[model samples]
Target chain A: MKFKTFAMFVGPSVFLMLLFIAFPLVSVLLNSFQVTQPVFTTQEVETCSAGFLTQNCVTEVKTIPVLDENGDTVTTTEWVGFSSYANVLGGQRFVDAITSFDLGALLRIDFWRALRFTLTFTLITLPLVLGLGLAIAVVVNNATKAIKGPVIFVSLLPFIITPVIGGLSIRWLFYGDGIVTVWLEALFNTDLSIAANGWAIEFLMMFYRVWHVAPFAFVIFYAGLQTVNQDTLESAVIDGASRWERLRYVVIPHLMPLIVFITLIHLMDAYRAFEEVIAFSSESYRITLQYLTYDYLTPDDAGNRAISSASASAMLTMVGVVILLAAPLRRTWQEHRGR
Target chain B: MSDASLPRAMRQPLSLKLASNAFLLVWLLLAAFPLVWILAMSFKSPVDAFSSSAWEVLTGPRTLSDGNGVSIVDIVLGIALAWLAIKAATKLLMPMTVAEGTLHRIFNWAVVALGFGTLFVIGFFFFLPLVAAPLEGLLGPLGQPILGITTEHYQAVWVENAFYENFRNSLIVTVGVVTVSLTVGTLAGYGLARSGSTLAFWILIIALVFRALPHSVLVAGYLPVFINSAEILSPILGENAPTLYGQPLAVIAVLVSINQPFTIWMLRSFFQNIPVDLDESARVDGCTHFQAFRWVIMPVMWPGVITTGLFSFLLAYNDFLVTSLLLDASNQTMVPAIAGYFNRETTTTDQVEAVAAAVSITAPLFLLVMIFQRQIVSGLTAGAVKG
Candidate 1:
């Protein structure tokens, strides 16, 4: 009887999840494997190869074509399987576009540069956001009644403004002719074109992202901090522990679960960082995987499908790495909690 | 206890106090600087705003000549009024005369009025710009000279720019997406919550992993498949596929996919919060599983439904990337519409107009937040705390 009831309750969600979320993913997985077209013929290969490869050494390539509105002709084509993958890997496009376009060696250089940029952004912003959030939470937790309301309200204002508006505001603030840039230049006695350098762009993006996201972290941490056992802290104080010692020994350990939770969640959010980067920086600073995928998927691009799939696959691998690294920590936390 | 009689509670040294205060001051400045700068910039003209000397105004003494200076005026007036009221209350005792009583009553009413009035005025102006411009344009020659309070902006918004059409498209997309996602997600959440099976648990985890994939990446992948499917489905569906690409349906499909996991997560949490005893009682009373859920669980989860619905609604509304990618130029949402007006190589006037449009776009959202502030705050913080 209980089984029947539970089954009834679980049935609808299972069906919908399978239909909507799971189906598309399964389809993508299936499509990734299939050879969509016949391989390139020897005649065609010879015509294209010129002096690059030996004559009659035919490379089998599957072509995936994007059809136009009329569905008659192929608007664009991607040579799939090893050929496409080889193109991505071999710096062919980089060599071709280097003189005319500044698209650099995407596979070898751009990919790693973007990865490093994203990693640096995440590393700097994650700890800063966490630390700032925890500190704010501690202060708010300790604040007197008179000052609490205004402080909390002000602190929470960033949370209330949607990322779009907040990002735009940041963009306006740091744009070349804007106040922040001018002020920084004057103060530092040097030109600081925030948009010009990749590091500066990354830094600015991180600051905006942290500013927008920190309030959320602050509120969550504050809630978690409130649940911390006051007696534990008081006992630490009685035992002659300094404030830092008490925080380190009792509060930090207590906050570990929350820290992990927030970090994991924020890391996922950071990986998908798009709106702020798009709003704040030009396309040159497309230093994240998400931006790279977006660039590939832009309207006129021929490599939309393959590049998107490849980039998504890359992102999934990154997520897998994160999950692997965090799993042990998560298990330890869980065991500690259980104990 | 009196201030002198009360014991000092672990008094810190002056240096420590100073250091702490300095730290707090720096943080406060960091938090307040952007907002204060924007508030200041809003009053200044384009030239004055872009001037290098404007940064000095931040540190220097308050001056009206800095800008139109309404913000300063309001702040000063508020402080002075507060100070005066405090002085009057502390200095005086009984209401001896009609004048004193009237003054006190007026002051009391002023305070109350100011508190609510400020909120009201802010809301009014926010909405005013959005509506007034287009209305003034529609008013035509009679709307000549573009009065400071004119509805020219509203007219421009509506008739001149097809703002209403875009708004309609947005409305269709937002409503469709929210309704579809809510229906689908709520059912899914119920299933996940009720199912004791490990399969359900793993499926839930998979759903979350899918959700965690950056939206841009998903949308990037989604565009090709959707476009291809639309092509294939066109012969059968007929008129649907062509419309699907840049239409509200595209927005709805993308948003529903993006939002389903969050809805499931939130709804599952809400459903789990409800006691199992309610289900048992319902069952004992001869209600079937569906009936029990309908009568008992659904009502209890209404707040969750509303919260999730609002979130999905906001997500759909605030979204730009998917909307920009999927929708045609004519079918743009207000955010993208404003963004379009200020892309690379935009003119100064274009930037201002874009800002005006942006201000228009966000105004309604701000109003919605204010009206539903309680629900929003609770919904936002619900994930953090148990109760």
Candidate 2:
């Protein structure tokens, strides 16, 4: 295609992306370094009240947001560099917790607590999703032809389900007096509060993620399995390789690229985990980095939002994702260059 | 391939087959049971829906006494109608519309959907009762409640709570996103695929990075701008410009941009598969570049376009963060509206209604998967396996 034609064809899409995606990214980076607040001014007010038999008058100074001519609150923006980031990092409390070597106290800080859970959640579920997906793919590959379609269809339900709905569905199964909870209580002959316990909730969140994501991995791996080299497998078998050995040597090597592909996508997605926090209602005990930004941005009862802090947290999250993608991204770049 | 055709060494042993099947059964249960359980929960009264005993939830004896029960006749007829409707929609309505060509397809789909919906409403609400009332009188004992089910929760959600407004909002956002993304994406994707410049490669890489950013980051960036949008637009629109903060339009713009990268990548891969000879040959016949693209390339691109469009639809539809944060109460989508039902304390009945609302949203998705299972599967694997 001619460069002019190419430009013409891609112009609208490029414009939309620049105006929305690229612009917001730059805005977020800048906003993290600045603070915006309603300009407040102190004013003196006098009040008169009838108290029983006497009228009392008092004067007090109050701080209020100044309103402009159009009745909108006047606001001021200033360069604050890393102050917002410091605030999000828990300024003095972070230093104290680190100096005292108190891991528990460190986690009490929202940023550290969220970072701990998000990292663990992403790393833990990566292996489970991979393992379960591979197992299902292997088993289903060997199943009779009659059952393959139904198995694939049934397996896809969790993947296709809306994330919030899927999370809520699992939550309902283990929530208070829920079916699984009731069954477990009867089996163990003890009271079991599944949702109240932090570890159990964490386990459920991981379990739900693996269950939700494994199907995606399975489908991709299953497709990879179809093109596996039968000649290599047969040659390995002729050389007296066991079933597990043949798989280890032959099948896995063929699927390595796909494993890396899935890993990259999974890491990108799981690092931004937000739905599980809401679906499980874990805000009180557990929160992810994405949710932390949302919390900062959410308006309080007084309608005050920490926009600067939210920007800082968002920047921190984007940094985390880019770090996770670094290796695979370099590999992709190299491969493209080679091509 | 069948087991008999495989060599003895390649075949699975009998014990392994049994264990594998058993494992698959367990997994299938894990994957599918929640949807089935939730579907069951949506129909029962609050007492039965949340009961400790599974059998109680299934039978709903409390619901029967509340005069909201289903006789054997109702159950049989209801299942029959549901099965028939699904069959007709998938096997008949879908292909018929596809045959109607591009411009008319949307109109045909709307007609089929609205027609089926009206039929179901008439059948379930009026026709079923009219037929069952006389039959119940004829067989006194047999007509009594065999299984308890109720539509009250569904009524509360769709009618009393006005969840249809949210559904409409969701429809507007998804439709707007899919249409705009696919339109722009196809052009950009074809352009990139045919052009082998370094700039094209660099653009794809940048898009990949953009695709990976957390949605909340973008929202935070959009938040301050949206709040001040009215003032920003006042000079342009002569002082009556509306704030974009609480509108569905804002969600659409953000979602489209978020979805564009994936859409272009998928479509570009699809376009790469089409032999360039088709369009080149058209150009050789004196057709302009745009003419060749529109007349020659687009006809073969429908499958890819539909597949990309399905994914774009899913992203817009499944989104919660952008929609919930950007849109206000009156313009909330179904997912956030359902979340609102449980965000605060509510009665048991209200909780059940929320369950009903959750189930309601899944129905359209179920139909979508049923009709386009092939497209969805291919679309997913296209990125992973082919690209």
Candidate 3:
């Protein structure tokens, strides 16, 4: 292709990406370092009110946002450097908690609390998803041909359903005298409240994530299983390798790149764990970093949003993604160079 | 060895086979039960929907007392009609339209779906009651309630709550995002696939990074711009330029950009698989680059395009965050609207209605999976296997 044609073909996509993805990144960085506030002015006026038998007048002062000619609030933006970041990171309260060696206090700060859950959720689910996915793939691989299609179809329901809806379905199953809870209560002869406990909510959230994501992993791994080297497997069998040995050595090694691929995709996705927070309504007990940023952006009753802090939190999330991506990215770069 | 032939070492032992099948059954249940359970709950009354007893949820005895039971005739006719529709769609409608290619097939599908929906409405509401009322009086026991099922929650949702409006908005957003993303993505992907330039590779790597960034990060960046877009555009379009905030178009643009990276990566891999020699020969035969691409390349790119389009459709349709934040109440999409039912105070009736809404949204997805399961499976493996 000529450079002109290539440019023509790639131009619109590049433009949109740069405008939406690239520009927003730079803007987020800049905004994180600045604060915007509506300018306020204090005013006093005499007020008259009709009493039961007499009129009473009083002068009172109130602060109000100054409106411009267009009836929009007049706002000013000022550079605040890292103050917003500090605020989002808990500022002096974080320092106090750290200096006091208070683990509970450290976890009490919203940012740290969110970070802990986000990291734990991502890390814990990785192994479970991988293991369950691999197990399903292997079992399905061994199944009769007639059953494979239906099995795959059934497995895909969880992955293909909307994330929020999937979460909601699982929540309905386990929350407040839900069928599963009821069954468990009957079996154990004890009462159980899933929603009332933080640990249970966290467990359910992770369980939902694993349920939702493992099918995706299964699909990918199943695809990977098809291309596994039969000659290598036969050679291992000839060498008297047991079934587990054959899998541990021949099969898993073949699927390692795919495992990495799934891991990278899973990490990227699980880091932005926002829907589970809403679907499970775990705001009181648990929140993820993405939800923390969203919480900041959502306006309160006073119609005030923490835009700067939201930006800071968003930037921090992007940084976390980049860090998680570093190893896989470097491996890709090396492979590209080697090729 | 042939694929059907299993070597002794490769085959599962008897005990292993039983255990594996058992495990697979357990997993299959785990995977499919929630959707089945939810769909069942949607048709029952609130009491039955939330009942601690699984048997009550399944039977919906309270729903029967509430004058919402389905007669044997209704059940038999409903199932027969549904079976006939599926058979017609597969055996007749599919063959008739599939030969005309993608666009025609899609149009045909829409027509068929619309026809089916109309038939269903007429059968359930207008025709079934009219027939069943007299039949129930005549047959007595035979025409009595065999199951407790109701469409009342669906009525409350799609009619009373006007959930159809959100469904319409969702359709618009998904359609716009898919069309725009695929158009731009296919061109760029083809360009990148054909180009051996280092810049293309680097661009792809950057796109990978962009794809990894959490959606909230992008939304944070877009929020300020969208909120002030009227001001930004006023200089170019006069003082009355409209704000991009709360507009479906704004959501479409954001979703397209968010989806573009994955789109490009997937499409580029697909494009790379098509032998370049076909286009090369077209160029040799006095075709311009654009003509070669259009006449020679795109003709064969349909499968890849359709696969990529399915994924793009899924992303845009399944999205909750961008749509919720960018759109206002009147313009809200189905996912966010369903979430709204729980966000506020709600009665048991409202919760069941919300369940109906959730089930309603999943119906199209179910249809999509049934029809496009092969395409979806291939699409999932396309990126991972190639990359």
**Candidate 3 structure quality by residue, lDDT tens digits, B199-219:** 787889999999998888888
lDDT of 1 at B158: 61
**Each candidate's DockQ score against the native complex?**
0.28, 0.74, 0.77
- Residues B226-330 of candidate 1 have per-residue lDDT tens digits of 667766788888776563567677678778877877788888877787888997799899998788878877767777787788888888888877887777787
TM-score of each: 0.74, 0.96, 0.96
Question: Rank order by lDDT, top first?
Answer: 3, 2, 1
Badly placed stretches (over 4 Å) of model 3 are A46-60, B1-4, B129-139
Comparing 1 and 3 on TM-score, the stronger one: 3
Going through the candidates in order, what is the number of backbone clashes in each?
Answer: 17, 0, 0
Candidate 1 chain A, poorest ten consecutive residues by summed lDDT: A38-47
Q: What does the lDDT read for residue B377 in candidate 1?
A: 52
Better of 2 and 3 by lDDT: 3
In candidate 2, position B290 carries an lDDT of 92
The 10-residue segment with the lowest total lDDT in model 3 chain B: B1-10
Task: Score residue B41 of candidate 2 by CA lDDT.
Answer: 92
State in Å the error of residue A283, model 2: 0.4
